[model samples]
Every structure is written in structure tokens, then in C-alpha cells.
Target: MSFNVGLSGLNAANTALNVTGNNIANSATTGFKSSRAEFGDVYANSLFLGSAKNGVGSGVTTEQISQQFNQGTITNTGASLDMAINGNGFFMTSDNGARVYTRAGAFGTDKSGNIVDANNNQLMGYGVDTDGKVVQGVLIPLKVDTSALAPKPSDSLSETMNLNSSAVAPSVTPFDAKDTNTYNYSFSTDIYDSQGNSHSLSQYFVKDNTNQWTMYATVDGVNPHDPTSTVPYTATLNFSSAGVLGTTSVGTPTVGAGFTQAANGKFTLTDWVPAAKNAAGVMAANGSAPADGGLVMNMTATTSYNTSSAVTAKDQNGYATGSLTTLSIDGEGNMFGTYSNGKSKTIGQVVLANFANVQGLTPNGNTGWRESASSGVPVVGAPQSGTMGTLNAGALEESNVDLTAELVNLIKAQSNYQANAKTISTQSTIMQTIIQMT
Candidate 1:
């Protein structure tokens, strides 16, 4: 009986020593939690015992190994994909078909463009819709869309120009693009078509008389609405005596295309043939114009000032297809993909899950945990919502193990083992003396 008791004590000491050694070994591991060995006294009563006071303790037995899920220190890595949780939640991931949870945020893109851990297990999160909004449905492996972004057709153009009010009328009778004497001032702007091809559109202003001027607009030396027609679209601008723009009228008869005049000389260019390089490398008209002309020339900001003609401001809406440039994550774990075309889209968000009892979680290796019966069902939510924690981008969480504490526990376990060994030795010596006396 004494031998059995001493053996149990030795086993308990060995278990405590193993636990402390494991903690010390993983002290530098990321997102590693420390464990402690619990013990209980073993006692038994004889069937013929007359009183309970006669019963004696047997030995110590290992009760349970409890894990501490405490927060660790967060360190920056300057990598956009590296993330760390700041509160009481774990980053959900998927392996084979089962869901797992982890605090290690070291993640990167895989060959299939999925955000994955070092083991290539995909990180789980809410997927995105066509418009880049979260679906709010079942959690799945988060994928980074790596396809090139399509180009958007030019829908509108805007510019503000000034005409010289003090300049005299041109000496030439008819307006000409090459002859400088035919017009008083000119301006040029680049516009895009459905295919993202660029075409230069120029405009000339001729002072016909006081508070009156004739304007001619051309696209790549041809009329925008009709590429075959060499005649440019013409309009007459009528201004108030105080230099404010007033009424406007088209000079040429409506021949299937021209400027659609609006209030305050704001004309919308109607019809446009998308310009492209032909077989001979020369720009030719392609039948790909915007159905709505897609060009808005704003002369509302035009003024008859006594200065040189100048284009003060200009803006257009069009771009070519672009590739992904970089990515970023916010505190809410929203991952945004920035493209080369100066556009950005939300890819996905890192979803987190918390449990009612973190200690009840079962370790599944790879610094991850699986839900167990002791732990209640996971509460799913986005970061910063309810008890869930926010994320820190470009960073990671260090292990929570304390080397100093583990070392101290190691010494205590060694002492317990020695005491148990001494008990066994003393028991053996007494047994030998009893045999010799008998």
C-alpha cells in the first residue's frame, strides 16, 4: 500500500513537471497558451473499519490540466496582412471541412488567392456581393479577387475656361483651325470612349461682336457625333453686358448630330464615335459611342474677363483596366483592395467567434482550438461588436506564457519528486528491517 501511494505521488510530480516544461518550451511561440496541472488527494476506507477517523490518505492524483486563455502582447510587423485581435475573441479558420479558431494572425495569400495560415488552411469570414458588400450569410473561406478590374466608359466631362473680353474681333471672315486670325482663343481636352481609348477634343472661340461669340468644337479634327463629317459642331454664345453668360444657339442646322444646348451655355455634346487605331495605325472612328453622348461641356464657369484665355479646371470620368496594387485592413477587419486605376474595393472582413467559457476549448494544435461540450456554442460577430475584440493590422500577438513563473513551477515539481522518492526509500528500508527481525 505504501509503495502504491509513493508511486502515485511520483506520477503526480512527473505530470506537473511536464506541464511546466511545456510552458517554458513554448514561451516564445506565437499565440500559445500556458497550462497548469491540478491535483486531488486520494483516500480509501476499509469495509471493516469501525470509525471514519481510521481511514488514511493514499496519495495525490492529477485532477485536470487547465489552459489559460489570457491576452498576449501585440507587436507590429509592418505587413498589411499580419493581424492581431485586441480583445476576447479568436480568428475563425477552416481545415478540411471543420471550423477552427485561432489567435495567431500570421496570414498570407495562397496560390488560389485565398487568405490562409502557414498551413494553407483558409481563413473564414463573410463573403462579398457583386457590389463588394458583405453577404451576411454563412461563413466561408475568404478569397481575394485577383482578376483585373474592367474599364469604365467615359460618361461625363467638365471644364472651366475664360475668354478675353478686351480682345478685338478676328480679321478673317470664316473660322479655320489652322489660321490663327480666324479665332480669338482655343482649348483642348482628352476624353475616353467605351474601350477606354483616348481622343483629343478641341474648341475654338471667335469674338463675333460685343457680348457675342461663335464656338466650334471638334474631336480628333472631326465632328464627335459624326466621324465622317469634317464640319465641327458650332454654337453661338450670348453674354450679358456685365460678362455673365446668357443664352446660346447652335449655328448649323440640326443634321443628325451637334450640341444639345442647356441653360447658361451648358451644352451636352450628342453622339460620339469612339476613336481607335486602325490597320494603318491611324486613329479611326469605331461605332462604340456612348448612347447618351457621355460628354458634358460646362461653360457656366466661363467669363469674359480681360485676361488671356485659360482653362482653370477640368475633370473626366473614365479609366482603363487595372491590376491590384496593394491591400489594407481597418480596425473593424475590413480588407480593402486598391487597384492601379486609382480605385478601391472591399474584399472581405476577418470574422471572429467567442465562447462562453474559453477554458473549455479543446486544443487542436497549430495554435488553434475546437469547440467542446464544456464550452458553449460560439457567438459569431464582426470585430468590435459586443464582446468581440477589434483587430490591429500589420501586427501579431505573442505567446502569453511567462518564463519566470514556469521556471519557479519547475523547481517546485522537482522538490515534490524528490520528496516522493525519499518516501519510497524510507518505506523500503523499514520493510527490509521487518523481514530481518522476522
Candidate 2:
């Protein structure tokens, strides 16, 4: 009995040592969780003995090994693809068709542009639609689109400007784009066409009377109506005595051949053809057209004030075709790709999976865990949503193992092993003395 007890004790201590060694060994591993070994005592008794006041234990037996799921420290790695969870959640990945969960966020792009971990497991995420909105419920492998972004034609122009109410009209008879004497002030901006080509749209403002002005516009220094003609598109501006712009009192504003002003007082340039300077210094059509809905110009914010004529703010919605420049991830796990044209779009959103019983998960190799029957179904969601955690891009979570505590456990296990060995040795000595007495 003593020999059996000693052997069991030795086995329990050895298991403890092994568990501690494993914890210490994985102290530097990413997303590693520590574990502990538990033991139970064994006893044997007869039914006739009933409840004996003093019962000797038969031996010790291994009970179970439990895992600790404490939070680990996050460290910045400066890698764009690396991610770390700030709270509770795991990154769900797919190896072939099998799904696994992990806290290790060391990821990179595979050859096909899919985001994958070191084991080539593809990271699952919610994909975006054509409008760049996240589509939930459906899970797909996240991919980075490296194709060039198509250009968008200029469809709207918003300008806020102040025209000098005290200035006199220009002395010149006809409007000339090159002659400064022909117009009081000029504003020029770059607008994109359907083919991603750039063209200059210039607006020349001439003070006609105390509260009236004549505005002339040109595309590439030529008439928008006729590219071969230098005659520019003309419009009249009427301002009230209070310096507020009123409805048109002269020639009505027109765009293209038949496009006219809407009831909202906004002018739409429907027929402005994109043009470029030829080798002979003549502006000609470059085979590009305006946006599908035409370009709407909002001049309602323009006012004739006593101040100097100046454009306070002006903006146009258009951009040239661009290539991917950089990628970034936000706290909500939204992956954004910035283009060379100074535009950013959502590529995809990363989804995290959480379980009701994290300890119930079965450990798979490569720092991943498979969902077991004991572990409840995965509660998958985007980061920062509901009880899920937020993501920290360019960072990683270190192991939860504590080396100092493991080292102390190592010493305790070693002492327990020695004490058990002494027990067996003492029992053998007793047997030897009994044999000598015989």
C-alpha cells in the first residue's frame, strides 16, 4: 500500500512539474494561456465498515488540468496587418473549411490578397457591398483589393464667395479670359471628367452695376457650348439692395444646349465637354463628357457685400483614378484603403467570435482552438459591438504566462517529488528490517 501511495504521489508531482514547465516555456509565445494541474485523493473501504472515523487514503490520482484565460499585455509591433484585442473576443479564422478561433492577431496578406495568419489560415470577416457598407450575417474571408480606383466625374460644385458691392463694372466692352481689364475677379478650379481627365473650369465675375454682376464661365479657355469658339457661357447675377442675390433679371443661365435652371435656383452645366490644349495652343474636346446627371453649381451662397471680392470656400466632388496607397484599421475593426487620389474607402470589416465557455474549447495546434460541444456556440460580431472588444491595429497580445510564478511552482513540484521518493525509501527500509528480524 505504501509503495502504491508513493508511486501515485510521484506521478502527481511529475504532472505538476510538466504543467509548470510548459507554462514557463510558452511565456514568450503570443496569445498563450497558462494552465494548472489538479489532483484528487483515492480511498478504498468496505460496506460493512459503514462510516469509519479514521480512514487511510489509498493513493493520489490526477483529477483534471484547467486553463487560465486571463488577459495578456498588448504590445505595439508597428506592423500594419497585426491586430490585438483590447478586451474579450477572439479572431475567427478558417483553415480550409474548418473554423477556429484564436487571440493571436499576427496576420499578413497571402498571394491572392486574402488576409491570413502564419499557418495560412484565412481570417474571416464581414464583406462590404458596392456602396462600401458592411454586410452582416454572412461571413467571408477578408481580402484587399489592389486594383486602381475608377475616377468619378464632377457632379456638383459648391462655392461661397463675396462680390464687392461698391466696385464699378469693367471698362472693357467684351469679356476676354486673358485680359484682366475684362473682369473684376476670376476663380478657377480643377474638375474631373468621365475618363478621369482633368480640365480647368474658370468663372470670371464682372461688376455691372451697384448690386448687379455678369459672370462668364469657360472650360479650358474655350466656350463650353462650342469648343472651337472663344465665346464663353454668360449669366447675369442680380443682387438686392440688402446685398442678397435675387432671381435672374437678365439672360437666363443655361448649360449645354437645352439644360436650364431648376426651380431651386441651381445651375446645372450639362453640356460642358472636357477639353485640352492642342499642339497649336488651341483648346479642343478630349473625348470626355460630364457626369451622368450633369454638374450642378450652387451659387446661392454668393453675396454682394462692401468687402473685397474673394472666394471664401469652394469645393467640387470629383477625383482622378488612383492606385492603392496605404491600408489602416480602426477601433471598430474597419479596414480602410487610402488611394493616391486622396480618397479612402472601406475594404472590409473584421469580425470577432466569443464563446460562453472559453475554457471548454479544445486546443488545436498553432495557437488556435476548435469549438467543442462543451463550449457554447460562437457569438460572432464586429469589434466594439455589444460586449465584444475593440481592436488595436499594428499591435499584438503577448502570452498570459507568468515566468516568476511558474518558477515558484517548479520548486514546489520538485520538493513534492523528493518527499514522495523518501516515503518509498523509508517503506523499503522497514521491509529490510523486518527481513533481518526474521
| Most TM-score-accurate candidate | 2
Clashing pairs in 1: none
- Relative to the true structure, candidate 2 reaches a TM of 0.93
Question: How does candidate 2 score on lDDT?
Answer: 0.88
Displacement of the residue 106 alpha carbon in candidate 2, Å: 0.6
Measured by lDDT, the strongest candidate is 2
Question: How high is each candidate's TM-score?
Answer: 0.81, 0.93
* CA-lDDT, candidates in order: 0.84, 0.88
Q: What lDDT tens digits, residue by residue, belong to model 2 across residues 1-438? A: 489999999999999999999999899989888999999998886676766447889889999888888889999999989999989899999999799899999999988999999999999999999988989999999999999999999999999999999888888878788999989999898998998888898999888887779888887786677676666777788888998888752243333352456533467788876456689988666788889988888888989889999999998989999999999999999999999999999999999999999888999978899999988899999999988999999999999998899999999999999999999999999999999999
Per-residue lDDT of model 1, residues 18-95, tens digit only: 999989988888888899999999878666657656677898889999998889999999998899999889999989
Model 2, residue 391: what's the lDDT? Answer: 98
Worst 10 residues of 1 by lDDT: 251-260
